[model samples]
Target: MEFRQDINGLRALAVLVVVLFHFGLAPVSGGFAGVDVFFVISGYLMTGIVFSRMEQGRFSLPDFWLARGRRILPALLAVCATLLLLGWFRLSPMDYKMLGKHALYSVTFLSNFIYQGESGYFDAASQDKWLLHTWSLSVEWQFYMLYPLWLLGARAVSRHPRAPVWAVWAAFAASLAASAVWTTRAPTQAYFQLAFRAWELLAGALVFLHAPRLQASPGQRSALALAGLAAIVCSCLHFTHDTPWPGMAALLPVGGAALVIAAARHGLWLTGNPVAQALGRWSYSIYLWHWPVWAALAYYGAHRQPAAIAAGIAASVVLGMLSFRLVEQPAARLLNRSGTRPRVALALSAACAAVLLPAGLVYVLHGVEQRLSPKVLAIAKEDGNRFKDRVACEFHPGAADPLPRCVLGDRKDVRLIVWGDSHASAVVTAVAEAVPHGVAYYGYQSCPTATGVHYRGWDNTCVAFNEAVLADMRALPPQAPVLIVNRFASYVFGKDAGNPEPVPGVVMDDEPQLSTRPELEAAYKRRLIGMLCRVRQTGREVFVLESLPEMTVYVPNHLARALLRGERPDDVKVSMADYRARNAVVGAWLQEARTTCGVRLLDPTPYLCADGWCGGSRRLQPLYFDTNHLSERGNRVLLPLFRQAFGGLGARKLAAQPAATGQGG
Candidate 1:
């Protein structure tokens, strides 16, 4: 139980890689493995504390729980409170609501579950989540809650002293197998959840139970420690965001950390260096403060600026130093001293409620929309509320009603049948309001509206959806237009820069080349053109919307940042040349259809782009809900264009639309 400076230095190593990885600095591509390293260290230290206390016959479960609560909750509550305060002035209603939910999750030690259902750990949207880093803390806290109970149960049931050690290794083996299999199939669960991560922490417990040899020479221990450090560095340098996580791959860092701890050398430069020890001491708070600062920078579109990243890192370290002195140290001193247990417990519950109650109010009040004026709220609108609900019929499958049953206009029988992916669904409300004809909408997320091609991992979902839509087109009158809409450039060039996840390669049923980019792009254009001609052959006219301009930043977030800074969010524009270049192949294929299949092309460029630039917002509203999907208000610009071709305007007129009202957030 003695203070091991090497362990402190190990803490430095873990936090350094994680911080560097999050900041997109240096070459620590696999820096996320640092969390694995910390798991090992915690297992060793906490197990040591529990067993040592038991030997002295003074161990109390409430006391153990209190010690952990004091260490984790104080500094955590500080970060969440600071973020909520900053969010009051800076975040849009939607993001503020999300932050409220995230804050509640963080303080309650359940963020891992919240994040598990949301998105991948390495997603671009991670920038929007101020408390995304708290998932690991939740994982560690879950382990802390369960580990000692398993130990006390094991000691009571078995006469053998070695029972818990055997149990730890047994659990490690079982968890390792499960982690590998689950990571391969359901990576989000493997990465963000604790079931797959328990083995790494248990490996550290094994290190404690089977202590390192005392007879080993100093030279051997130093060599062992250095080798452990090398293993950790190699994992960070060589692995990347795409690496399968917390599986067999994580053993490198977990094993490496266990070796460093077991080596028990306190004087080696790597483990004993002054800077290393300081970072180690401040590691917990540094981890807490670093992400919120960088998340703010990311919100303002400066995450990649070298100076901004430098400033963010500096700010995080300074904030960490201040938090350590003001919050972490004081809480540690008070709770570690003798006092009435119930008083400490009562105060802890009160602090949690203090943070939790306000967060709950923020979420329940809908991010308190009164924070912004009518003009700003107009741009923010249903986007700030539950937008997905409005579009749910198109994007989500209904058990009772078919997906295509989701119509845009009031009339049940539809003349204009819209077909595409979620991008198509996003424009339904606007399209319904713009056109006089009743619209039959069919949208499947991430599914390109083509007959023969699909994403590499996907089966026949998109192809099948397109077939069903084409059948509906065949049943309609010749005058009824079959509109083809999708985020087409994604099929050709992969996801936009602002999008998360590794690019899913396009695959064709007949292509000789499997998932190669060039071959896939060629096949995509061919299949798209073929589908349009097929629509023409179905005896219906085909209208294709030119791909909308995609922004490099999530539009709502950018606009909110701009407005918070007293700048015009509508002033935002992206390079038109760049948009044209990104979709050059798509445009060419659509143009080819005009001659080969009589398909008409409608360009969103005029509505979204002007003077060699594509804007994310206009005078009244932001153009997009996220990176590429147009907001309902923003998509209203397309109503004029759609009306010109389809020949009917709905009851709602865009110009006559009233401005949205607001509430204080």
Candidate 2:
């Protein structure tokens, strides 16, 4: 349980990388490895304490938990309470409501699981989370609850010989293998799951188990410390978000941290280093405090301001110092005092309950709207339904029911069956313009239009639903134009400059295999032709609508701000350059299809952004209602584009007159 100065330096290293990455600095793409470094260090320190005590025959569960509570709770409570109070005035209804749920989860040490169940860690949706970093703390706490007992059980089994070490190693190997498999099967789940993450901790545990030998000589120890430092630095600089994690990729940081800890006792360079020792002292507090500050800026949409961002980072450092002095030190002393720890723990737990109970109730009731704005409530309801709709579609909501969840647009003279997942669902309001009021809209949300491509994530119902759709398409009128569109970015496979290099795992149907731009273009061309051939067999003309442009910021939130400031909605659109660039790539691939297979590529660039200006929302109208999804108002603007692509439809004729104006006010 002795302090390791080198580990603190590692913490400084991890926090520095994470902060740099969050601030949008260049090429620290593998900066997320800081979390992995922390994970290994946590396991090492925590297991060290438990194993040391168990060997002394003095281990107690209550004492162990009290120590953890003292270590983690004070700062966490401070941040969550601060956020809750600030949310009262600063947050929008939806944002505030989301905070309430997070507050509840934070108190219960379940935020990671909650986030995993909702937005996976890499999702853009996760940025709005004020307590996203709390998930890691939760993961650690969950590990602590089970880890000590496992250690003790193994020790007991071997009659206190080498059983515990063997047990730890076995667990490490098993967990590592499990993590490797799960990383590819479900990367998000792999990132958050305790089972998958346990191996990272075990890597540290194994180091602690062999601590005596690792700390043998000063010369050897210095080398180990330097190697550990190098490994962590390399991980921070080279590892990225796309890196197949918790697999073999995580070994560098985990191993590095273990080496640092094992070498610190004998290494004069690390143990005597003033900066390393100082950072090590405040590392725990810094880790707890820094993320909430960064997350708060993200939640309030203030992360773009360089000055505000600098101030926020500085504030986090100040808070960490304060917590170390005023909270962590005092709480640790109190917990160490005989017979006082349990009572203090009970009181803190009670306080946590007091905060969480009301927050949970608020979330359950969906309190952000204050019930005055039914329109906002309606939109929230619709958004909630979209997730359910996605699930249902993936599970095959049936045609045998009284009324199908989705109906194909079969009644229109030119039946335009728009298809894809939620990306298509978002644009259905715009696509609906081509259909008469009574026409059927058949595509279900999350149900991809790909006929032969099998999805592995969902239930077997997806296969059946896909087969049914193909069968229905075979029977459709030949005059119908089937439009295939989905969020192709989700399926795109390549080295992500934004994340670390990905180690491709198991190959599945529809998984992208191309590594280069030329290879990707070729694959895209083949996929398009394959899709086109399938549609032609069904005797339908196919209109492949290339993906639409998206704004740099959250579209609805950004548009809302513009409207609030009285900007012209038509003048707020971003430059069409990026959108055009992406399409140019896709279009190049589609050219072969256009020449040989007669597939028409529809690009809405000119109409979506007329005369070099892509517009924003006005006081009278909203542009994008979601990140990339256009609003009803925004879709109305794009009606001209839709009309041009399909031919013979006007924006005026396509849009129904709004019942009133000044919405999103």
Candidate 3:
């Protein structure tokens, strides 16, 4: 097969967009389409190789696999080794364990499956993962493992000259149909799984199979090339993290890439340019190095700043260039020199095991905690246990009744009910410590205290859960106080309040349409007022905790890494101005409720935020686990405020009680 400068240029374009997107550059919000571009390119190139060889009756499975091994393994092994070395000293025990687990998956080409089981690619935590980008590589590798066999088999069995092409088209159609269905039903899995992604590669195969028949007049070629570029550019500009991906939305970039490949014979200057060729030569190495560089910067708290992004890109290019020259080319030449494919395969397999064994050990030994101080290790380990108590007290929508174990404090004299979402669950320990009598916790995942807010993603079970909590609250004693704590910013602003997903439903009361921000805000306020009025009518005193300052970064993880490096952990606190800005609408609604609905508002900001900074830790203990939820020890920081709010209930006498402790939910 002859080399195509235009195809190399497409590689350059794809890699550039992906790097830019990963850098948090604002202009290319849809830069994720770069992966789609790569998928198409891979499909076209690989199919071209297989089809041409098969047609000549010279297709060798071992030779093809060996070639692929040479192309992919060297750079990937180098990157994994480098990350493992870096992580050994810089990562906390838990982070190191996760890194090792991911590295093992990366070497085995199962990272996509592992990551799908763990988190969505666009999730905030994904930024911390050094091997996250390898999921795409894994998907491609899985496709390569089977695609050649399928093509060869089709050629052998079918009498039709274009049987292989027909087979590729059939697979493409079936995979495309699955992508459409699974993308809506299980987007994360669809995004990472081969079954849902094969159509993209098949699209490229179709382009290659039909290339000889795609002759065009110069004018038509120019128009087609321009249209292809436009399609790619538009998708890159318009798509976002929220976009349903690699399904219908993916067709734009896949078709565009296909068009570019089909029209490449006409000599599109931009696709054959020198700069494009250079980037294309280094594209694989660049993709391998960029993610870990970005992840390292984030670990050290440089995050999305211009300086950090610049440094990461510079490091990636330098490292990528070095790897291409010093590692990849040399390794490929050495592997190709071997006369037998079995020898090359054995050598590659041995090298892969050498890399994966230590990674497996790291996971088995739980990140080797002996490397860090117990104090630092403790903080790092605390993240896993943050939700323990909530898990115990969780109330389901259709359960028989509220479990007695859900009640905290003195269950014999239950006086208050803590009701809301996970935010309500988060402060259960502090609320338990502050009140003399028992407090029943009714924490349901993603269910807000506000009434009539419907999440498009949530089923009726969420609504039923909210109703169940309300019913329990009405059953409380007349004089008992009901403390309503939720991450109110989410409902009013329709933003993720450090939760992985958006709150399931939209506010549907005032504006059933829920069409605009103002309308959503108004709807949220009305729902909150109704919730407050209902609780008051039940004769329970209503106390609403003002929204806590939501940190933009996961504080504990950031602090853990910083502390491991002997940097000042306190430097990671959120600014009061930024916290207030994010919560402004929720703050206004809280004030309105206090003034108009006769609800007692408890503000923890004075303690949590001071001197222009909202603290993320106190006395070397992390205050919040992730971006917003208070840690077990961090929740104690608000105990004084809890005391003041419940003072009318004679909490002073209970102050002598030892602070309650329970496993995290």
TM-score on alpha carbons, each prediction: 0.87, 0.79, 0.83
Q: Tens-digit lDDT track for model 3 on 547-575?
A: 88887676766667778899865644778
Task: Output the lDDT of residue 76, model 2.
Answer: 80
What are the candidates' C-alpha RMSDs?
5.8, 6.8, 5.1
Tell me which of candidates 1 and 2 scores higher on TM-score.
1
Better candidate by TM-score, 2 or 3: 3
Best prediction by TM-score: 1
* Candidate 2 TM-score, C-alpha based: 0.79
Sort all candidates by TM-score, best to worst.
1, 3, 2
**Which tens-of-lDDT digit does each residue in 1-665 have in candidate 1?**
78899999999999888888889876999999898998999889888888788778887888898889988999999899888888888788888899999998998889999998887566657788999999999999998888888877877888687776676787788888999999987888888877899999888888888865445788989988998999999999999877888788998988899889889888899878999999999999999998998888888779999999989888988898889989999987776563789878887888889899989999998787898877667655635422354444553333333334455553434567677877777676666666675666677777887668876545655676677666554444445677778888787666754442333357776663555555566677778888888878877778888898988876666666677678854555689888888788778888998989898888888877878888877753567777788876678878878778676534333222122111000
